[model samples]
Target: MLELDGTTMCKPGPLNPSIRAHSSTLTNKRSRRIKGCGALWGEIDHAQGVPAMLLISIQTLLRGALMVGGVSVVLAFSPLPVAAQERMPMRIAVEGAFPPFNYLDANNKLQGFDIDIANALCETGKFECQFIIEKWDDMIPDLIAEKYDAIISSMSMSLERRQKVAFTEKYYNSPSVFIARKDSPITDVSPAALNGKKLGVTSSTAQESYANHFYPDMKKTVFRSSPELYKGLSDGRVDIILEDKLAIYDWIANTKAGTCCAFKGPDLVDVTFFGEGAGIAVRLDDKERLARLNEALKTIKEDGTYDMINAKYFPFSIQ
Candidate 1:
């Protein structure tokens, strides 16, 4: 405390007895206050009539309190405001080789049923989005890890997968079938015809499921992709390939083996083996994002965009 010792200032300092005594008194008071506060900062008020250090300390405390309070509020409401929600380009994953569902179009673009539907969804949901190609087998694991925000590669809805990822209602319907080389002699075949022959299918797919369930007598050969399954048939490694009907028709129509193979027999998709139509796959944790995707899917299906996407790929409706 820099006290203005008013009683001692008027006394002369040339060995004046009263002046020496007053100076001693003032020193005592300053020492007492400094000992109490452990600071010379609290002495400023006595000299200047107001303390800048005290005001600064008070301001710092208030600011710190506000910071803690703000953190608590943010923690309590993690749902950020629209602007605060991190603005990121939505990434949609696709199985790049699946023609008409999401193949590399002639122009080298991801174009197909899934691609168009996903674009419309981004537009309706007001988000910037991009599509990236990935293998089908990696889709679920990648999606769960948030490698992409969603997948729109004609992934089907099943009770098993539903336990892992969220799905929209059916986007479009199609059937599954088998493609056999015309010379293979399996085209004129029955489900029983595959009894001893090796039939190829994509692993973990509806085709694989149907093949195992319906043709339990056959040797089931599973590959990682539909193209690979077809390749196995082409190389005579497998008698035929079981997969999506439209995929078979499209590939056979577009390839050198066009004259060599065809989709033989009726559609294997009877809800008994193949589940309902395909839908977009989303992470299970993103309730908000999932809701937006579902709404967009519903709107497109109703306003005929989805049907148009259907017409571009499949010729007949699934009953």
Candidate 2:
């Protein structure tokens, strides 16, 4: 039996038609053993042990195991050994460099939407959360390989991605916008106009698909990170870059990447190349975690917490 620590259990992935385990899934074998004949009770007090005991009880109940007044749960073959609830920390993967959404602050501490929301989710889910800065390129592969439990990077939920990994409810959304040299001889760049132009985009992303589908004749250069893509455009390696409008505004205001470049229309929306805005990424097998995330997301959105977080980073309403 493979022992899946919380870290190795849930990996990041895109929803796909052909589903792979992505990683070793914890069976929660439940260790169903014949109990004290029927109602063998262990420490079932929530205050004495860890809150996680509640989960064990819940799991046992869901498996057709009976609950004995919340004191001891009746198992099919259980005088359950009832291990003390362990509040172990959960491991998370993130692109620690994306700004506003999830980035390393001046203090070297991770700060961003994903970071904040991850923490909030941990609180709600009652699991310790640790974030690892994984590259965008490797997020899905490593996640499927069981590198981490979840990815809180600014990943969009789209049909293409859904084919590979499962996504939580959308948390943030921004439309796509074209970035070009401010003084370039272009008003509105049409797919035809880009026939021979060098266009830079994030490789293997919806952005690439958008360009390929819309402007097949246009030359496309794909970079791994936003900074790289921005640099490619600023250095004149590429004529234009299509990216999120919010990110574009941030780059233009914060760095010289936007100094000579301006966002050219037609504008980009969630449905464009980026698909839908940001959401949490998890393996397809994590039904519990995915279901939990959706529940928490619904609660946060209903309580206005999500909107508050969004307002702190983005002023304009993109919904």
Candidate 3:
């Protein structure tokens, strides 16, 4: 006879002939189950018969552990998303010598139509802008070297310029005009009409290019700057001076040199010489910044800011 001291465990009783055979088979099955448990679950004791609830608990623990392990592995291998970066203040380059477009006042501080337009663009773009005065000759190279982010110095949009940098839509366009003393009798602008006349133009400007290309027969004198060109006209060094119509008009109304001159015949503008018009220039690689600038330009033009600026500088529309 066998007895369980504290637990209510089942016990085998005495058996007759048929019951003895069944008892032997049941004992054999119990031994096999115990052996299987020892092999797969060595920590579980099987001599007292395996507990059904214990097997359920083990399965639940194993499944939970596997789920946690899988989640940890995925988290270790996966990459997190990165945040967007903010842009720095943009540095804009302008030619201080170009008046009406840009120039220095009596205080030597930069002020002009170009400067106002630049400020408007920056304000509309929601970005801080700093204007730096640079020579027109070195503007493109300096931009490529990252010295400045853009040029708003009345730079004409040309195929030759597009090779090195990108340009926004034309901000302004004006026809080139010839200026002569009101007393001078230079009326016709035809090539044949000005055969013996001497023409004065700023060097490296569209006026000079036009003079050389179309009126090669006329005597041409090139000056380094606008003041020099006007000086040549006032001094009688040249019979007629070709330049931007609006700029000359401003000079005539404001400066003493312009007082002696008046428009000779007609306003001349050819895309080959003057290009599409003056535009803001940026480095070719900076497409994103250029896009922002273009957007800002459109915003200002549509918001009445552009018209206000035009009214401040001129009695007529220059847009």
* Best candidate according to TM-score: 2
TM-score order, best first, reads: 2, 3, 1
- The lowest-lDDT stretch of 10 consecutive residues in candidate 1 is 31-40
TM-score pick, better of 1 and 2: 2
Instruction: List candidate 3 segments past 4 Å from native.
Output: 1-87
Better of 2 and 3 by lDDT: 3
Q: Per-residue lDDT for 1-319 in model 3, tens only?
A: 1111211112212212121100111132211100000111122121222356955765565554335745632222221111111222566676666678787666445667887787666655643455555555667888888876788888877667888899999898888888898889888989999998999988777778788988999998988667678889998999998998876777889987778988888778688778788899998888877777788788879988889888888998877
Q: How many residue pairs clash in each candidate?
A: 0, 15, 0
Q: Tell me the whole-model lDDT of each prediction, alpha carbons only.
A: 0.62, 0.64, 0.67
Q: For candidate 3, what is the TM-score? A: 0.70
Question: Number of clashes in model 3?
Answer: 0
Q: How accurate is candidate 2 locally (lDDT)?
A: 0.64
Which residue pairs does candidate 3 place in steric collision? none
Which pairs clash in model 1? Answer: none
On residues 174-232, what C-alpha lDDT tens digit does candidate 1 reach at each position? 78877788876665557666788888888778777767767888887888666667778
